[model samples]
Target: MAIIKVLKRENPYVQIDKTGIDDPNLSWEATGLLTYLVGRPNNWKINIAHLSSVKKNKETSTRKALLELRKYNYCHLFEIRKGGKYIEKFYLVFEVPTQYDEISSNMDVELKEGEKIFYVKVKKERNSNNLPEVENQLMVENIENKGVLPNVEKPKMVKPKVENQALINKELLNNNRMNKEKNHEYDFEEKDDDLRKIEKLFKEFGIDFSIKHKIKIKELLQKNSVDFLISHFKKQYEILKKKENVKSIAAVMSKHLFQGTCEVDSSFLLKKEQENQLQLQKEEKEMKQLNNALQVFLTLPMEKQEAIESEILKKRKEINPQIKKISTFLFHKMIVSDIEILLAKEKLI
Candidate 1:
């Protein structure tokens, strides 16, 4: 809530008869003059010729009233020289009594003017703490000279260049070419070592280097390193030998072993499988039961169903008014009698 304070300035004189000459042609120049004079300091003066243009007759009447007001100590008249010519000036010097205080005080003041009472309202300036100080001479001088105070220069921001898809693709292609070249170099070095190892093995074993044998060795050398190929072949030979040994061992074990000697019950596995099948059957039966219940509920007469719903709604209203509101909105088109029957069938009444 905003806090406002009332300020009042009392009128020094009261009107007796208060009958004004009424003319639609009457101008607001007099009013403007009064407002301008009232806003100035006591000793401030303004030239009469400077008043905005008005009808001659109205201007004469306004000037006459102003003079009368001046005689009554409401204003002061003076003469000033401007451009070597003497001009008549008006100065309103009357003191206007006003009360000043914090806006938080909720006191209201009424000002009397003739037969009318006017209310004076005052409001605290918003964000007064954030307002610039009027007494900052250096800032004021800078603003007067440059129209704005000097401030620290801000660094200009640089925008990042966006790479197009074509440029990105070109960079990726160059990287892949370099990687392929490096891979080719590694492959040549590895193949040279494997070829030397093959030649040495052939010489040591006194194996015939026929064209078919050379082609087979070259094909194997292309796929793997020399050490890796030797280890893989050894592993394959061991696996074959182990498989034969395992078959012999199994044959002996089966001949000596009997069913009575084993403690594991094979029927337990069959029973577990049967239990799982029964669980699936039970789930299917429960689904069928639910489907039957839903069909039975759906087959009931519309009137009976509506009656049950109404009865359910009435019970729900007793339990929670919010639920009743929601249910009423959902089933607003249903008959009251049918809803009552629905509630009775469901034993919810």
Candidate 2:
């Protein structure tokens, strides 16, 4: 018979079952092992070193104690496959386990004395100490512009305040200047490009844009677009090249070009100008009609205008079924009416 034992302490204690203490079938060694195993968590696994309680305890004595414990059925000792071979495992079942493989992988398997378990590990290899670290992508910055001993003191960025419209404009101007400087590092190339365009335009117009003319044209380009100045140059070149000079070119520019009186013998330009004026007049007349229509439509009730729009759109479908929306239908019809008036005035189809 074994005697039940309760080892008590100030802050901790262990519960030992009286069955292991009083059972006559268990030897003293088995009883001691059973008492130790029963006091542990039911899911914990016992090892040889755990059975021996001391660092220098003999492995043979621990093995015999385990064998004595197994004979009395206090726990289970079994073999299982781990890393491809059979290995002995102990399950502190206290009672006989129905499932032979009851020892789970998560069971608290005790380690041998002096065994070190490192949860975190350092890889053993060449330069193993210098492992790569992850960092934020946007946080990386150039240190060269931050000044001397930059690593000692981080560069502070003070946001430029915009308290008023003038301050806001000043900040925007500074930002634009910086951006222009950085992005356009080739202003000379841009100037050369403009000169190339001017040369090409002169080639197209069958004239030499002379060095003096080039200087004057570059000055003009500061305010006018390349196409606008070049077109005007073409017009003046045609009139002055007929007059026997590029310096005489200034005559047309100073007198007629600025005053909108620069007329050339070009039937094509005249025709295009007339068409543009006629188109402008047509648009103005359409706008006037739309305004008048809007006034009359506004006088009617909302329902009446909606009904008239429906009827107008349905009629417009006879000309082109593609005009689907009421707004587009009315706008197209008004434009067509104005175009008809303009055609009648010009006596064209």
Candidate 3:
């Protein structure tokens, strides 16, 4: 996989501030290195180091160009450690990469008799997703100092209308009065002849009878019997109660809510049960270990056992890993150790 062609003017040129290299403070070698870097892809490596010393001003020219780029916030240098050695590379500061010459892992460059450049590629799949970090400390520090975080917004909250509050309270009290007349879950169990009974039944459940849920109940009642609707609603209510997921009295009344669906999707509850079982198993394992450790300690000589307990309670774990000014984890660990030692000592006595 090699192609050799005569190098000429770029068919498509990059748009950059060419006058940057002409600055009086910049070194002469910076202009050459900048041109060389802009010609290659973002994944390119500087090849001027391999040139003859007489023809080149040395690799310091390339270093100066890199320094200029860093000073202007154009790119960032990343050092990766490999085999006890460090390999340095530069990545573009901006997200959009500049790539004139696409690079591959085994690709190499060669100069021809003329000013032609050759590209050699050992074909391989394009690597994506696990790319190097493009963002640097400059981006983060700038945001921090300027108070510009990635996402900062307040959540919109629902507010009750003031005028409706008194009316809603009165309606709720009336509904409670109507519900008290009938002790059953649904009062319209045998009285489905009139829509008034159905409306009262809907109001008893704290649901609005004027909504689409009222229409839904009417349709279901027409299709099936009143007993069927009551049975289904009870089943749905039981499922919600079992999961301890009764969101609100309002949600139970709305057709869009889970309670209105009248379906026993136990998979959600099963997933929660599985999680609880795993947590219980972990807790049992920890208790078993603690009990075993206590039994072992009790078998030792009384003075040695007391010495071991004292040592265990006195020596704290190293807190080097903590970077916070005050570590709550270390404080909690100390409290837990004291409780555990006290309990074990009481059991032995």
TM-score per model over all chains: 0.17, 0.23, 0.21
What is the Å distance of residue 5 in model 3 from its true position? 85
Residue pair clashes in candidate 2: 1-22, 1-24, 2-21, 2-22, 2-23, 3-21
Evaluated against the true structure, the overall lDDT of model 3 is 0.47
Per residue, candidate 2 scores C-alpha lDDT tens digits across 229-348 of 667767676766665435645455555533546656666678999999999999998778655655555466768555655565454432322222212433343434544443344444
Q: After superposition on all CA atoms, what RMSD does each candidate show versus the true structure?
A: 36.3, 38.8, 26.1
**CA lDDT of every candidate:** 0.42, 0.50, 0.47
- lDDT-best of 1 and 2: 2
Error of 3 at 244 (Å): 25
| Best prediction by lDDT | 2
Which tens-of-lDDT digit does each residue in 1-349 have in candidate 3?
A: 1111111123366444455555564456655545554444433344335422524554444444545544443333333344535433324321122122322222233323333222222222233444453433233224224533345598999985687688989999999988876744353454346456556655766666665665566656656676666665556555655566676644653544324455455877789999999999999987775656555555778797556545553553221112111232322232344535655766742
Which order, best to worst by TM-score? 2, 3, 1
Say which prediction, candidate 1 or candidate 2, comes out ahead on TM-score: 2
How far is 71's C-alpha from truth in model 2 (Å)? 1.3
